[model samples]
Target: MKQLVRFFIIGMLVSGVLLYLISSLNQSQGYTGGNTLTIFNWGDYIDEELITQFEAETGIKIVYETFDSNEAMMTKIEQGGTSYDIAVPSEYMIDKMRQEDLLIPLDHDKLPNLKNIDERFLDLPFDPDNIYSVPYFWGTVGITYNAELLPDKTFTSWNDLWDPDLKNEIILIDGAREIIGMGLNSLGYSLNDTNKAHLQEAFDKLGTLTPNIKAIVGDENKLLMQNNEAAVAVLWSGDAADIMWENEAIDYVIPEEGSNLWFDNIVIPKTAKNIEAAHAFINFMLDAKVAAQNTEYVAYSTPNQAALQYMDPEMVADERFYPPPALTEKLEVYQNLGKRNLAYYNDLFLAFKMYGK
Candidate 1:
């Protein structure tokens, strides 16, 4: 009986050793059992497959969440119930977040792939030196029109949007800065003009466009344009590109008067619980091939210069989406106009919406 008991104990001891070795091996190969990174981003902004790839590669699970608007994202981060390790926000919002101390400075040493970004995108007015952010995607706000519907109309300027023939045939993106800026740009004033008189003039000008405005929408604008529901739309370049891809009849152009040149960048929120994993994700996204794949999926202009080689040559060559330096130089980036001025812009926009109603 004693000999049988000794054999039984030896067998149990060997099994325990084997289980410990297996666990250690799995961990070394990036099989982290509880590691996770939470991301707050714009809806439909990333390729879902990449999330799976990242998790498999690093064993760090992703808790992906999305917001439809920058304001909504900011509000949630400010509320502080959940700890988000990463968030994507536009340039102006990044400026606001930095001011509010809601972001943490990036450690460049961990983000070695940062060198892949184009020099033109870095050291910009917002987040100068990119202390708190890295360029994710960048594009302009402009007009997209259906060639089949407006065969005779070549929209080369913002003023063309006010054409009488276009009445009740135009869709506008639902954003105060974009719509108000369109009015401002039409008047040949700065999109960021903070003057009371200029703002009122812009407001009045938009009031005239009420007759032409078909509908104000968000993501649905793409579907409307694709289905030939609207003749023209004021859209972000990325959204325009997606629409054009679906409907060959669709064409996009930046008006001669210039418009908002915006940048959406990756940032680390102050409430990050997995700082290391956050850095890992940033570096993973910055990889040239990964960046190319993402831009291809999202239909956004990438700031990853090295990634261009991996992108479709014809798509990259399209000047409407990739404007020349001369044109880009003329474009304007939105600035944080402070809370009161921003509210004023929103109020004016709301009043304009009501005017249309």
Candidate 2:
């Protein structure tokens, strides 16, 4: 009986020690009993080195994936084939996701860095009061052209692309939203235009421009323009910076009638397994120094006001990255048009794709 009692005592002591070690490790890693969180973001959206730092500090594994289009990202999430913890989608898709009940409202109290964001971006129509998402980067879609090549072209407006002389020399963005939005804006209609007549008119205009188009590529439209495969292309300001960095021949211009300005936000999904860890990662990125580094590397704008103080004064003054207030006045952020309107958009967009092809 004494021998059995000794064995029981030893086993209890061993179990206690093991449990204590496990608890200690968990506390150190902030692993409060949950699965690792998965993140879906655009390529080059965040600095990988920074991400590694976050993972090392928090002990939460972030499974990162990339998609070029918001539609493609939404499709993956909606299919339910894989689980994701966080997704970085632009202004429009965020609204759609919220409407579909695919996103959960965020707890702002958990995110002290929320204060770092500019008040202008907060409480917008999409995710009003900044409840669903935290703004990551914001930019405008505009024309980036080989200015040297088009010295005599005098490109200043969206209509300049339709010049008969430039036929077969222009590259267009392959994404439906951007291409269609351009046509709508050119015709004095909303980017979220739902009227059948307005859409048909835009589609016809696009069809005319399609035949003369050199190619349809996206995100990389600026690259094509820089390589002189095409003289002009519709591209994001960040992509324009990439092109200019590679080949200084190109310059971007916000169309006189204006273009779409968009914000990409970070959000913790309802499926996020490590909520606290996610918040910690977000807060770290929002830190002024970290945010400024990200802005310089990514060639994008941070909505973080504090980060602006850390940015290079020259970059801040650059019209290409930070268009003057007068230029921004002409641009608009798209709102969530209802499902019926989206269906209209899809149908018209598909038609344009088919006809253009």
Candidate 3:
């Protein structure tokens, strides 16, 4: 009996050691010997499959996190708890980040596939040399309206939103710059116009829109428009496409007066610790197959000319979703105003939100 007990104890000890060894080995494989690359991006923004493939190809695990808005992302970075190796921000925010010297100048040699980008996107007012950012997706801001709800409305111009007929029928994006930009565009002023008189004009014009607006909201507006609860919603074109695809009554239109042309680009923050890994991940994203996959997943237009060949021919052919040259001429990309001007614009937005005309 004593010998049998001894054998049982020995077997248990061996099993315990084996389990510990297995656990440690797993911990090593799951974690990359501290070789993990952290990426911060918008929610539902990238094809997660790409992340898995990137890890498989580079053996560098990725720690991915998401933020809903540019403000939330920038706030988290400013708070300084986490160090993201790569972050995706829109063109205007890139200018803000660059002005603060928060971005690291990317090594273009490492991003050789950049030639895949449309030249029109390069050397813009924001990061003119393409020093700090790489194009991820590009699109326009426009109107998405439920045509069935207002059969009489032609909705060809931003002025239609101001039509007394739209009263209590519109749900505008709860974005300061976006709202103000719309007002500016409708009134024939530059969306990035810094002239005090021009901004005042926009503010006045927006005040007129305040009472007619059902609500100023973010993603919730998607549900509102999808349900046909609101006749109109001004939002990003990609979002409009998604919603329109689901509901036939809804249609997206860029008002004839024009609208904002925007791009979200991948950039490395100055605080980045995994610089080489960040470069690798970006290069992986730039791969033609990877870029096409991301475009389909996000349903946003890609700046990678090479990736288009891999996209659905019908989608690529649809001019409504992807603007043609003539439409491109009418779109205005946002530029970051100086600090005081930005503060003023924010204040104007807040004031308009608080007090209606």
Candidate 4:
């Protein structure tokens, strides 16, 4: 009898210990009584310190994930493999997601800090009334050239990239919309031109510049330009700013013929499981000081007007990155061309790449 009683007590004690450990594990994973906010964003796009700070202050855990392209991000979200509370996608992608009902309309009451965003960045065509997205960063696509390598040459327009002197010296960003848009803009056609004839004309024109195209690249374009491996590159303003900061000989220009103006915004995906925590995270990031710090770290143009007070005055005054309303209004924002049109653009750009090779 005594031996049986001892065995029962031992079993009860072990069960209580196991239950305690299980409860602790559940709390850590946010399964039972904790909050977790999952975020999908671009790689190296944010100041990670902010993530830690947010978690510390709000007691909400963060599950951060990154993607290299909008298409990749969209595919993963659509797959329903993981529930994402927030995603930062380009304006065009935001429109695409909205049309497909892959996003949830934002509740403004939870985003009082929305007032900090610049008026110019709000009410955009992609998310009218700021219902589905809020602007994170805005920048122009333009040329960044090593002035030391091309002492006498200046790139005032996209046509300059086709100059014989620049043969085999230019690197273009590897994006169908951007490169194709460049060809279109150079011909005085809309970057978002849907006219097949016009697009063909642009494609044929791009073929003529094949000799001047040394390589088509993505993020590595920044590294190549900084190392002076390429004399000229079609690059985004924020990336140009970063490269120029590292290389004194580098300079950026917005072509006279105009170019793309892109906006990346934050939104809630349809798979969001923690809506309240997501809103808290958004409002936390929109705070003036936080936004300023994030922009400084990422070297991107901030769309939070209130954050300007906390940023360097000189950086704010650089028109190339922070152009006045007049110049920005002249730049075209990418439209959400349907899949067919988008695929057509991609196909033409692929042909252009092959022609260059």
Candidate 5:
């Protein structure tokens, strides 16, 4: 009977040890189903192969989604109570997110690979001191012209879009800020101007271009340009670059008066579910080698000076990718205009469409 009692005790102890090991294994496996990192970004902006490669290297699954505009993205995130690990948004929108208290402060120390970034692109007014975001790609909005379509004409300034020759042959950027800003730039006014007269003048200027414009577009400029539906368009540098590959006749030019210098950055929202993984992803992309590859593939400017050294000289030398030093000096980065100004800007755009037509 004592021997039987000893056997029962030993079996119970062994079962307890097994139960403990099972519990530990379950905990180590992480929350219930599995771990997935969700990324929200603009469409066609990253290399899928690179994402796959990142997943393979890190053992983290990447689930990516895209939105066409910052407002839409913000709304969805707010409404859905969405939990995303990382997101890429443009400069002004970053300020909006920050203002809304929708973003989390980044721990730069967690991103050692940030050393690859050029100091010049760091510490902008939007994310001063580089505390909230990391720039992933940089570009300027510029005029993309088909040299074959208008060989005789020289296009130099935003005013050139008003040329009668471009009538029904040009495309304007769809965003009110860009279209109005172009007009404002042409009129020697600040792009962020809130004064009624200045905005009216911008509206008038855009009205003049409207008769000439074939379409107002969001992201279809490259396709339209490639197919010859658009002879000239104001386009993002990367989009222009991608189309230029298939059609060498296309050329990109920054308006002589100057244009906006913009950067899209990786930011972790306050609602992020996986902060550590987000940092890991940012650090991974910030690697000079990785940045070089991404910049080359996406045909965008790198904010990474160290990455530039590792990039092909052809990419570095592409005038569209890296404008002349003098042009760079004249360029301005956009800041988030306050809410009242935003309402005014929207009103101006509506007026343009309603009466300027």
Candidate 6:
């Protein structure tokens, strides 16, 4: 009887310890069961140190999560089970979300630091009135190639992705919008091609390159290129910047054929329960020093003009951040594709992924 009571007491003690640990973790995450600000961001997009700093400074607990793509982030919110105070989405998505009324018009009066943003990134077509978003990171989609792996291969355009010699030596992005968009741009068409026939052309064009592509990958392009797993890869400038810093043997290019110029912005969601905290976090990020720290950490271009002063001059001079005027003049920004064409693109994307190989 005594042994049974002792065993019960031990079990109770263990349960108590576990409950305490869980509570402590929640507290550390700022879930204090109150005043928590939830942020859904891109994977590894922020300087984590800044998150800690913000938490310490404001005493508002941060509940953080990450989404790999804008579509995935949209689905989560639209499904209505999860709630986040802030989300980072690219240009096209800002338009899509605003159209769907998933975002709240930001109270700029609460965001004085918005002034620090570069004028060039402001008043853009996607969110022209600056009613709903603030530019965070902006970059271009381009190619990264291995010098030794491609020996003597000239890569001045997206046409190179279809070159016969690159068979099984190339990697393409898995995202439907990016892959098809590149195909469209390669043909001198808009990356946001919405016409049914034009999108079909993009699908057919991309299909031709599938036989030569080693794989259609997303974030995996980082390790794939770093290890020289492929001779060339369709990659974003932000990632290209960091990877080149790690491997000098690789180089990036803004294909003369042009590519997508994108901006990922910060916005409060309609479901944001803590508006004050969300605005505070956005304002904190707009601080020049903080913006530079994030850009330096993530290797993405910042829309914060003042942050340039703190950036490495060499990095600033590098074409990855500041491409030649010849290419920049032609870079195209994607617009939201309405339902009909979005489905057309998605259908072709599905068909490509399932049977192209």
The whole-model lDDT of each prediction reads 0.92, 0.80, 0.87, 0.91, 0.84, 0.87
lDDT tens per residue, model 6, 27-139: 77658645889999999899999999998999988888999889999999888767799999888898989888999888898888999998878888899878999999989
Local error of candidate 4 at 248, Å? 2.9
Q: What would the per-residue lDDT of candidate 2 be over residues 27-59, giving only the tens digit for each residue?
A: 676545564667889987888877777777776
Put down candidate 1 lDDT per residue, 160-248, tens digits, no spaces.
99999998999999999999999999999999899999999999999999999999998899999999999999999989988988999
User: Which scores better on lDDT, 1 or 3?
Assistant: 1
The most accurate candidate by lDDT is 1
> After superposing candidate 4, which stretches have Cα over 4 Å from the reference?
1-33
Q: How badly does each model clash, as a count of residue pairs?
A: 0, 1, 0, 0, 0, 1
Candidate 5 least-lDDT 10 residues: 26-35
TM-score of 6: 0.85
Question: In model 1, which regions exceed 4 Å deviation?
Answer: 1-34
Worst 10 residues of 1 by lDDT: 25-34
lDDT for 285 (candidate 6): 97
Clashing pairs in 2: 123-129
Distance (Å) between predicted and true CA of 97, model 2?
2.1
Q: What is the lDDT of candidate 2?
A: 0.80
- The model with the greater TM-score, 2 or 5, is 5
Question: 59 in model 2: Cα distance from truth in Å?
Answer: 5.0
Count clashing residue pairs in model 6: 1
Candidate 4 lDDT tens digits, 133-157:
9899999999999999999998889
**Model 5, 29: alpha-carbon shift in Å?**
12
Candidates 2 and 3: which is better by TM-score? 3
